[model samples]
Target: MSAGAPGGGSLDPVPEPTGGIEADVRRLAEYIGGTERRLAALPPVPDRAPHDRDRAVAVHVRARRARRAFLARHTETVYGVLTDGLTRPVRLADLVYEAADRFPGLVPTRAQMAAERRFVQAEKEGREIDQGIFCGAVLRSPTAGRHLVETMLRPTPRARTLLDGFRTEGRIELDTVYLERRGVAGHIEFRNAARLNAEDDRLIADLETAVDLVLLDDVIKVGVLRGGTVDHPKYRGRRVFSAGVNLTDLRDGRISFVEFLLGRELGYVNKMLRGLLTAPSPGDGRERSVGKPWIGAVDTFAIGGGMQLLLVLDHVIAEENAYLSLPAAEEGIVPGLGNLRLTRLTGARLARQVVLGGRRIAATEPEARYVCDTVVPAEDMDGAVDRAVEALRAPAVSANRHMLTVAEEPLDLYRAYLAEFAVVQAERTYAPDVLAKVERRWQERERRRAARGSVR
Candidate 1:
């Protein structure tokens, strides 16, 4: 939705302008520190089968070799990149030049050297990030089939104690009331499992929640829901909205479980934000500014879309013991949401490594510094999220929306992200090898899910 008319003097009411870049930077720094500490605090994740270090190394080497071969064949035309005034890009060129610059001891063949040079040039002249505007939204998925919307409301002593047990970025309000509805009347309770998911619905069913938050004039949040019922699903023809589910558990092999983590279920988040912005609240009839929300919860296999969902949100709360794997590259699948968020938030180099490498990036690992927000103790995750939610709620809505604009829009990151998706689709449709790998991966995942008793 559009803001309250451009020249309306409404912007100052929001804290966006007040925070400035320094404020944003400070916030980012705190968040990053939190992320690092969280990772450091976690217990080590259990290793999976075929987890042999040597074998994994061999696979990586093979992948690198393939990449070099590909470069050898096509370096001059597409790979040589150019950047402006960036030392990293320039240094890359020097490396390539040294490797090939008519030196006697150069290991790579002339063709390979030429490819490296091209890639370096492209890197030098690549896209730049400008502190432009950023905007986006969070979506929550509803239960499908026989399942319905459920929520926990009102804090219980046990819930409060559990919430107070951790160090978190937000406030913790335990047990609030949990409510749910099907085709009939809805129910609300204070039980922990107020929001529950049956094992069987973890596969395909594909229920979704969508919201659309934008930063045109300022941040505007709108949400639309289709699948799950609400706490009071009867507010102004809609139920008075309450915070949705705080997903925690999931069976390992369910693809839908991964899909849910990716926040694919919340595909409608953007849509919802849009709707909210379109509606007007009776204020002083003066202009108003808004900011986006920071949200996160525990995710177990936030691979694909699940990871992307995290990218969209400014803050994330991940369980240290949880498995976070992304095999998009291995499967020749383009990481749509994940790449978009990573590139914008983390930058090109790290984002490329994470996306192109197409391997798992563990939160506890040194290399995971750039990707994760906080690697928290698994049992303490619910408490941590509670605090995170509380802190996020403390911010004025206007300021949140404005910052969202800054995060989402700067450097035209989203534009490039959309471009990547186009590239992926073209490859899938035209590149037989890539298409085959993607299809194979899809089928393999399906098989694994079935073996794990997934209905898919």
Candidate 2:
């Protein structure tokens, strides 16, 4: 009873395949028939197609599958390679040597190059980031501009992620935005350390949107006279009725200081000033329109271009114990920006005396007529600035506008602005003749000292 099925036919287990052979055979045949049809559905190869090429096709198919899988896992690396290939190849040796030469590992990466190129392109394009807080409009009160302030989504580093991807945002021109930040009461032209650049001419031509308040901060002072080097950033510009404040250079010892100032580090600031003076803020209805001048907190040495920044401002606040110097003359280089500014503020004779003398004048020196305003202790600097700002702010708007317009009446100021490049050309010629030898001598001494120290 246990071994036998109900009818005893299946008592002995069938030794054959468990699946029905006939059914399985039918299914197999159908699968084969389908496969045959699929194969036949393909377009026939031309007689001209090479026989070896068919082997190539199989290899390609296999490679494509493998590649697809590989790319899925290593997408970042693959993309990096693709980007590297698309760009001009930079030899590892060349990059390494460049790193070794001065700034180790500071070689621009592909991404950095791309960023720089985008920055350059943005400058080339007319996409202006309107950081000018004034925009040729003044607020009724100190915080009034804040209420009216509506930032345009420009491609600055801060605003980039806030708006779009890291694309270019054209050259910037400094406007009242500077003054608004400095807490100035009235409109004055301002430029910060950010706006100094080597290619100022091109930037001016393409990026000049309007001209109004020109603003620049004298953050550092570097001068050489009589066998001494005065290197610092902060300097007193023109202070009319207040204790002067000083702008100091915080990043003086590093070698990258020069490149950083002229390159991306300071390019935006340079653009800001260029844009403002080139294109002043439009005047308000029945009133003078432009942003007021103000100096925010400054850090870092303002070398040649930085020193020259004093000429742009009408007033200054110098912090106590700040160093001011112009050593470009000693280095066989012309102080391009400083020369222009000096020529404008002082007569040609005084300008030459101050600049060509190549000496660092003290901020409080009474004998040197270079300082425009009174000097105050660093502690009293801010209070002085506040008083000056209040005084300027209280003036009738129309009167302030008239004064600014009149300030530009001098032929020297107008000419300097018009022919800004005269200083540049002069620098190219004078820098080598006068300054290069001095710089080389300094460089050699430093090298020798470094070598001796290394031996020890």
Candidate 3:
């Protein structure tokens, strides 16, 4: 018997189901088809007067929930069959897209609603919603899988040599970052203490280089990101994790949109996701896990982009007093990747509270616990990180991490999220109003700092 090609293509003659995985695939396809039919039967959004909009939205929401419930019921089966090596991995995204396309009324296509919400929010609140939420909503749309597949299929820029100008077995210090391989873990510390370790273009570049070095080093089994000493009066002689992006550069127009995207998405985050020189395996054609497990050691606070960085980490150890916030809503910018990954940790409601509501999550808060795996006293942070590192370096931990990563998050999700993020952020970053707002806020911040005599 031959299995039909996706999207009603000519039936391709294939081998009969061996009554194992192939049988499972057939069952899953049947379920998907059934769900798609049910979705197709739902009433489409109304195009009439304002009075009908609410009813149309309600109907659409109901259909979306039903679709979600169907997907949930068969999630394990779908994930298992897709990753079972029966079909080409390259076709997975296409399969998801086809399944989604079958149900046209699933929560309104992303393209339709993407700009509407932004405009509505801006009209009501006097400014647009955080770019993170705007972009995240688009990425989470049912049709987003298509965009994600295209992104994963796109080639990444070639990385520079890890040892291009570095010494072999000693501590390496750049202008704004520090790196040292100690035994099984490579420690990459953000060292621009004077700026509260805020990441500028140079700092981002150095951090990416450090990540590459950690990936290139065979002796390194894990990578750790933390902060070095801060000499400012308030944080003198203390570790202060990071204060996120350098707002000064942003306000001064020194940061380019492409630079920010490449540095975060392609540079460090991709390294964290794809690992070092690891290509997809021939058998499964899945991206291999060559990246080491990452442990984030947070002291003080991780704000804005700093908080977003935590999403890519495998484990996070934060100090008791450490707080995390994504104040992009107020800053008139988007927190990179935070919306896509934060919701996975804290759920949609709380993620919204933080991203849209501008809530600051204390380290001891329940939401903070969800984001950080472990919290310790400031003094015990070092010990906790060491223990976590030791635990991560245990036998089979790397393999286990890789398996869980693939089974749970998968590379395509990140690709899809970032692909949308890149476009949306580019638009927001260069918008005349957004730039003006950012600069005005920068001036306000400077004025307040000067009045307090704490300007850095």
Winning model by TM-score: 3
Off by over 4 Å in 1: 1-276, 279-292, 367-369, 407-431, 438-456
For every model shown, what is its TM-score relative to the native structure?
0.39, 0.38, 0.63
The pairs that clash in candidate 3 are 148-416
TM-score of 1: 0.39
Candidate with better lDDT, 1 vs 3: 3
lDDT of residue 19 for candidate 3: 38
Relative to the unseen true structure, what is the C-alpha lDDT of residue 307 in candidate 3, on a scale of 0 to 100?
89
User: What Cα-based lDDT does every candidate model obtain?
Assistant: 0.33, 0.31, 0.62
Q: Against the hidden true structure, what lDDT does model 1 obtain?
A: 0.33
Worst 10 residues of 2 by lDDT: 125-134
The TM-score of predicted model 2 comes to: 0.38
Clashes of each: 76, 60, 1
Over 4 Å off in model 3, which ranges?
Answer: 1-167, 279-289, 448-456
| Model 1: residue 233 alpha-carbon error in angstroms | 35
Q: Looking at model 3, report the run of 10 residues with the lowest lDDT sum.
A: 120-129
Give lDDT tens digits, candidate 3, residues 138-217: 34444443333323332233224445344465467878988988888889999998889888887876877788777766
Better of 1 and 2 by lDDT: 1
